[model samples]
Target: MSARMQVRLWLWQRISAALLAPLVLIHLGTIIYAVHAGLSAAAILGRLHGNLWFGGFYALFVLACAVHAPIGVAKMAEEWLGWRGARVTSLAAVFALLLLAGGLRAVYGVVLS
Candidate 1:
């Protein structure tokens, strides 16, 4: 990757990490609350259905994760696996897309179904 592109990726990864911290906390808190309340999966889904706020929050969380994870994976591939060049970047991009697709699909199911 070009120097400028690498810099941009670094910046994006940091920004995504900042976004994810609070998001993860909130997600975990919600799970704890649900479990403590003895809420079943169906009950939780019923409450979440058609809730745009919940949907939007989770979508952002998914997006942040997609952005954050690939950079780390790419870096790991470079450092640990001795990989580099466009192929590593392409694989990272593919992983990001998969994360985005799967995460959004799950969010859609919970929010719309």
Candidate 2:
């Protein structure tokens, strides 16, 4: 990758991490609250359905994860596996797309179904 591109990726990774920190805490807290309240999956979905704010929050969470994970994976591949160049970058991009698709699908199901 070009130096500028690498810098951009680094910036994005940090930005996504910043977004994720509080998101993850909120997500975990929600999970704990759900379990403590003995809420079933259906019950949770019932509350989430048609709730735009909840859906938007989770969508942002998914987006941050999509951006965050592949950058780390690409870096790991470079460091640990000694991989580089377009192929590694392409694979990382593919992984990010998959995360986005799957995560957003789940969010859609919960929020719209």
lDDT of 1 by residue, 38-80 (tens): 9999999999999999999999999999999999999999999
Error of 1 at 98 (Å): 0.2
Candidate 2 lDDT tens digits, 35-83? 9999998898899999999999999999999999999999999999989
Q: What is the TM-score of each candidate against the true structure?
A: 0.96, 0.94
TM-score for model 2?
Answer: 0.94
Off by over 4 Å in 2: none
